[model samples]
Target: MIITLPTILSIIRLFAGFLILLGFLLLARPAADILAFVVFVSAAITDFIDGYIARKFNLVSELGKILDSIADKILVIMAWIIIITYYEFNSWIILPIGLIIFRELFISGLREYLASKSLSLQVTFIAKLKTTLQMVTISLTFFSGIIVDGSGSLTTFLLQPVAGSGTTLMEMACIVLIWLSAIQTIYSGWEYFKTALGLMGTKNDG
Candidate 1:
């Protein structure tokens, strides 16, 4: 518990997740949605900053790693759930989100089990790409909602996709990114599981 700068930043990101949740709950007010958006974006930015600061200044620590992971899950999963609750969507959106959730939980368990045996499952570049894209998708969705709907009404995203061209294009890009993230999520999750299994001497051949 050295409480380094990166550790403090990670802690702030963790609390920002809850604040984002609070703002989303009060989305009846346009300002609340804005609040959530600001917090979400700020948290995402801090995520990058903390990682850079930790590496550059050698502030990385076990506590910081654990806290950063937990904060990421909270922020991403919470935002996904709120998006689902607010917007209307088809399987194109819902299915991807489902896959993302499943991947997160399953991979987290795999990591824990491996850790118990003093094993490490390294993260792949594609997995990092998936996470970044997912966050970007979430950010764009909230921004589009604010600009397209403009009143913070909690209904009608995909339900009324006939909004102007700019917003519609933005919505389409979000949908594409969601599916891409899901595909990478499954791929990365499988890779991690395979690596973990090998570490445990139970590597799957199929």
Candidate 2:
């Protein structure tokens, strides 16, 4: 089996996800954090580009599909775990993470079963939208820490201590986005399960 550029890009994205996870856990130098952010963002862009190029250039392959799915799951799960670690370990993150992980496992199993039976499940537009929201929310949350570093005039203005300020407004905005993403995650998971179940039932009837 020949390795293609898309497959290689997927691997890079997976590795970058692990790097981001490590950066979150280690809390190393600020410089290292910035580097991790750069790598993660670049990998994410490649993820989009790889799929686009693969489809556009008629280069899609089984290995590319597998690697792309693996890359996406690793990046999302790692991002959720890292967010929870940084945000004081709330159960809210855990709920969405569990739903997302379980849904991925369940859907993957269903897909394999269907494939064995010579059937295919179609991806829906809502699923794509859910993914887009999740990616944006996670990326924002990942870089939200920089808002407190006093880098820009806006950051300094926003970070200014109120009479009894404990948390910055920017941090609050990140939290809101994270929660909204979680809601989308749950909705998407439910939607996926419904679609899968319907497909399975139709296959069995056929």
Candidate 3:
């Protein structure tokens, strides 16, 4: 595939995911948190921009589709992985994040299998919704985990003075969003599975 603006943005997002992961890992320091936040938010913005550009410019190719999905997965999945790791493997954090991650991998494998057969799993509305929600949730989780304070001025982002209760509230909100996204993830995964089964001539009765 010829290189295009959308493809370039997708590539940027894919690389940004790793940088965000590294930055978040050292988020205890202000500089690292700022770095993570900048890269994370920029990547999140590009996710929408690239897709829009592709559709608008008739630049949507098979490679673009594949890269977009892969980039989305890498960004959010790795963020969640690192989050739970930072949480020291807490069950509460792991349950939702793990479910989301598992569904992503399962759906991804199905996509690969379909690809091998010269087929593709078109992304469903629910699948897109899950990714958007997951991104927002993860972004907020990062913000609260690093920044925010008690007075509820609701100042955003990391590492330059934050206090109690308000920060907890923000974290709680992030958790709720994560679980919501996880539920959507499962539903979307099932939708994809049904499509895959139909493609394989097996009726998904369940």
Candidate 4:
């Protein structure tokens, strides 16, 4: 496989996902949460950079496409795991998390089925919007945890308004957006399945 810049970036993104997971496991409370957010944000930035560079320079390749998709799934799913583990036990968070996971797995299977036929699914604009919402919600949720129970003077000073009741508001917003993103996720997944079904001749002809 060619070692293109975009491919290298996708590999880095995969590594960054592991680093973010390591940060969550090794670092202490507020610091762990903070580190995860910082690493995740950095990884998200690179995700965009790699895609743009690939499209602009025509560096897009089959390996790059597969690696990029795998990298994205790793990063976002890891973030969701962190969020589920850290957030307070509640149906609001749990339900959306479940939906998101289901969507990812189901759509992954759909994509694999298409791949077997030498076909690929086109990513919809709504799917991109869903990803942005998921990333923002995860970042905000991570930040919310850092200030949730009051991270003392330093964290408080840095977050100012993000402390006190601010954490609650952020948490609420995160939950709401998570739900919205899940809805979009299901819609996008359904679109993929519909396309796949039509292509596979599984759709009944009228």
Candidate 5:
């Protein structure tokens, strides 16, 4: 099998996911957060580039599709884990995480069932929007910590501002993004579940 550009891009995305996870472990100070931000942004870029290249070059393969989905899930899940671990544990984050994990698992099972029936489902536009929001939320939350760095403490630079510089604004912005992400997360999961059920000839139960 020839090593195509799409395959190479998919490989890059997988590596980038590993880098994001590694960044979570190594980023201790504001500077470390900066580094993590770089890694995360790079990973996000690779996600888009890989998919674009795959279609542009007509190099989409079964292996590429499987690897791409795996990479995306790993990156999103790892980023969520890192953010929740870095911040004060809140039940709010659990809702989004739970919804995300449940939706993915349910969809995967549905896909398997459909495949057994010689059926396939197409990815939807809302799914793409959900993914974009997830990426943005994760990236911003990671950077929000970097904006406020504390040594041997959970407080980030944004939380502890310099004299004459208020950190309230930054905190509010981060909170907004986090909440927006949570909403989108639930919406996306619902959309996925609805579509999956439709495929299986089932109606979505309220």
Candidate 6:
């Protein structure tokens, strides 16, 4: 495939995901948090921009589809993997993270199966909403974890509750959103599975 703007953006996102993982691992200073945040948010923005450009310019190709999906999975899945590694002992965190990963893999396999039959699974509105919610939730969680780890004034102002709860309010909010996103993930996965079944039935009929 010829190099295009959207493909270039997707490549950038793929590199951004690597940078995020490296920042989280090798960068020990508090400033590393800022680096991670910048790279991650930039990548997230490109995700939307690439899709819009591809559709608008009629540049969507088979390679674009594969690269786009790979970039997205690398970004979000790697973020979740790193997060869960730190919180492996916490069941609450692990459960939602596991669910999100499983849903992605399941849907991907379903899509591949349909593609083999010359059918395509179009993204749904709910799936887009779920992706947005997940991106926001992951971003906040990453930011808060860094701030909390650093124990800076920003954390005090944003995370600290007046009542002095054990868990910071921001942390609580992130966890809640994670769970909400996971629930939506399951729902959307179900929808995809249903579509796959429908397609399978149609294929069998003919």
CA-lDDT, candidates in order: 0.78, 0.74, 0.78, 0.81, 0.71, 0.84
**lDDT ranking of the models:** 6, 4, 1, 3, 2, 5
Give the runs in model 2 whose Cα sits over 4 Å from its true position: 25-29, 160-165
Which 10-residue window in model 2 sums to the lowest lDDT? 28-37
Find the candidate with the highest TM-score and give its number: 6
Clashes of each: 0, 0, 1, 0, 5, 0
| Cα TM-score of candidate 1 | 0.84
lDDT of model 4, residue 133: 83
State the lDDT of candidate 2 residue by residue for 1-31, as single tens digits: 8888888999888788788867756776455
- What lDDT would candidate 5 get against the real structure? 0.71
Considering lDDT, which of the candidate structures 4 and 5 is the better prediction for this target?
A: 4
- Could you tell me the lDDT of residue 202 within candidate 1? 52
Q: After superposition, how far is residue 35 of candidate 2 from its true place, in Å?
A: 2.8
> 1-206 in candidate 4: lDDT tens per residue?
57999899899888877887898778888888888888888888888999999999999998998899899898888888778876665666778888898899888888997888777788888788888888888887787777766767754554454445544455556777788888988888788788877877742342
**Structural similarity to truth (TM-score) of each candidate:** 0.84, 0.86, 0.84, 0.86, 0.80, 0.91
Query: How displaced is residue 25 in candidate 4, in Å?
Result: 1.4
The C-alpha stretches of model 5 lying farther than 4 A from their native spots are: 149-167, 202-206
Per-residue lDDT of model 1, residues 29-114, tens digit only:
55666787788888999998999999999998999999999988888998887777544655656788898999998888888888
Runs of candidate 6 with Cα error greater than 4 angstroms are: 85-88, 149-154, 161-165
- Give the per-residue lDDT digits (tens) of candidate 5, residues 73-120: 777777777666654565666666666666666666777777787667
Which wins on TM-score, candidate 5 or candidate 6?
6
Tens digit of lDDT per residue, candidate 6, span 52-141? 999998989877789899899888988887767555457998999899999998888888888888988889999999899989987887
